[model samples]
Target: MVLNDRIGSARFVTKTNATTLDPFKATEQGYLGVIVNGAPQFETLVEKVHNLRSVFDVRNLRKLSEVVIIYGYQDDPEYMYDAAISHHADGIIYAGTGAGSVSVRSEAGIRKAEEAGIIVIRSSRTGNGVVPVDKGLPGLVADSLNPAKARILLMTALTQTKNPELIQHYFRTY
Candidate 1:
């Protein structure tokens, strides 16, 4: 089955086959393409969809905020994190090496970003594997999501709230 989790572009629960698609349902769920299944076998709450859409609408109209993804490397210089802060990014998804571990210098930059009111999410550049919560880490973990997916969720989560706990909950949930 083509589950939403496997379809990189799917925003919500979607199932597809060869024929018969529901464009309306896909649109409602924030998808632009066709779904060959009847209705979505799984559905997200209307309230949730509304909230996500509202945030996207405001962002699209004003361009007041942005979400950035930065890759971590050995002996990292932290320039990308600093740049994100300077650019007024609303959120950052740090794709750290191995299980989302950043170099000392990069961590310092992350701390500065957090101090600047930018929410930082720790994800892995390893492509697959959960970035579990580490007490030593300065930001929320991205769970099993890769950097790109983490960025998408972080962008949506930032719209509803900046509370690290709540955003972390979203990472664990949707």
Candidate 2:
């Protein structure tokens, strides 16, 4: 079975056994489709698809910017966020406790990062649950994305644009 999803301008495909396919759940989760019965030819699938660029297309590839992820803890020091700035990172994903709630000191560091033109993304350290937008926060929210996924998206987004609003839109859309 082939499961497909799009991220930014990239299209990705995942191949799995047909017996493991769950059609309803896959579609509900926004997967493109599933092919059952027998193993499908991989080359035929890619060759027939039009307009979509190959994942290995070097010409269309953009060099990803540096993104750091900091795990927030109770009374944590601001060193992690500060280090990202010192290292000249393009973005920081804060994996905060609970629904992406950062420590006071972490928030202070995030403020400094924002001032230095680095984009900050608030994501939950918890395995699941959405992190909503908090206007009082210094940077953008990562929605339902975990810290790792948020970091990947942020790196790609930063390569395209530095606009906070546009980056936030990418979080919402992708």
Candidate 3:
């Protein structure tokens, strides 16, 4: 999307579209619902994302799906495992806490997602860097893009392919 405005002789324009799905409608009134594995790690940042003037002009806010954001309790691998196993998602993003790593149970869920033909990738909430593929990790192709941006990327990736290598390349090219 392109938006230009003039503030008393200062002219400005900016663009924010990254993914191709266009899951967001252009409305300038949207909200993002976040799902976390444990506590509210994004308490300060969420406020910033929502308060950004551009967000309101781009799309309206919506409630986040709670099944994914399992906060305020133990981070069970099965909760996500079950969600993917039950076909509740076309793609799943495992936002690891650091360096895009996963729990043992989380690994089990990831394997399940892959076996069941659901697109799966690693993500990190740290928002500092992209998730790199683990060389020895049994099944993961690559870190789920950048953890901050994995969910949207996964949604778009799933729309194209389910093969791990193809999807891994897609992550690199995307």
Candidate 4:
């Protein structure tokens, strides 16, 4: 329930105390670079998350954010999990390598983050596998949605509840 995530990434975001909310300024944060593994690319969907009213409102915060787009294959990924960790980000949308299988090294990193109380969601990096939500993995929570969708799902989930069980229920029904 504690997002003790050590990767204080938000600290790196530019200061907004001195700036005003502008769509152009908001766009400057750079695309969020969503690394989609599958789930046919849809223009409608892209606009849905990209043009989100809440995300747009973030620009008004001293913690403005950007949304970017990225693509990958089930075989090889280009992003390292730790960067997601070290960045001290608000959420980690991990697309697990297989069947939500995590590497030993990565698991430690994730476990450390989770123990630190970081919000960790196990997602299918394979793009097709279902994350084991009911099995009750000791250290983490199931993503419930495929990776691409998981980010948005988790983001909204955070606004309402940070409890693991509550998050799990949100995954099941939200």
The best candidate in terms of TM-score: 2
lDDT of each structure?
0.73, 0.74, 0.48, 0.47
Clashes of each: 0, 0, 15, 14
Instruction: Please give each candidate's TM-score.
Output: 0.67, 0.70, 0.52, 0.50
Cα deviation of 52, candidate 2, in Å: 4.2
The residue-by-residue lDDT of candidate 1 on 50-164, one tens digit each, is 3553434454444433799888999888778889989999999999999999899989999999999999999988765678899987989998777877887787677678899
Model 4 scores a TM of: 0.50
Residue-level lDDT of model 2, residues 43-83, one tens digit each, is 22332332334222335665788999999999999988889
lDDT of 3 by residue, 1-174 (tens): 211211110011112356754433322322222234532222222222223442123233243321132211136546656765685666666667676666777776677766776666666655445566787443443343443345555554555456678767756654
Candidate achieving higher TM-score, 2 or 4: 2
Residue 29, model 4: Cα distance from true site in angstroms = 36
Model 4 residue 49 lDDT score: 26
**Where is model 2 more than 4 Å wrong at Cα?**
1-35, 39-62
**Candidate 4, residues 1-174: lDDT per residue as tens digits?**
001111111211222245554212111222222324532322222222224543223333353121111222344333444455466565666566566766555556556666655577777655443577535343344444566566666676666556877777766553
Error in Å for residue 119 of model 1: 0.3
Give the TM-score comparing model 1 with the true structure, all chains together: 0.67
Model 2, backbone clash pairs (residues 3+ apart or across chains), number: 0
Candidate No. with top lDDT:
2
Q: For candidate 3, give the lDDT of residue 113.
A: 68
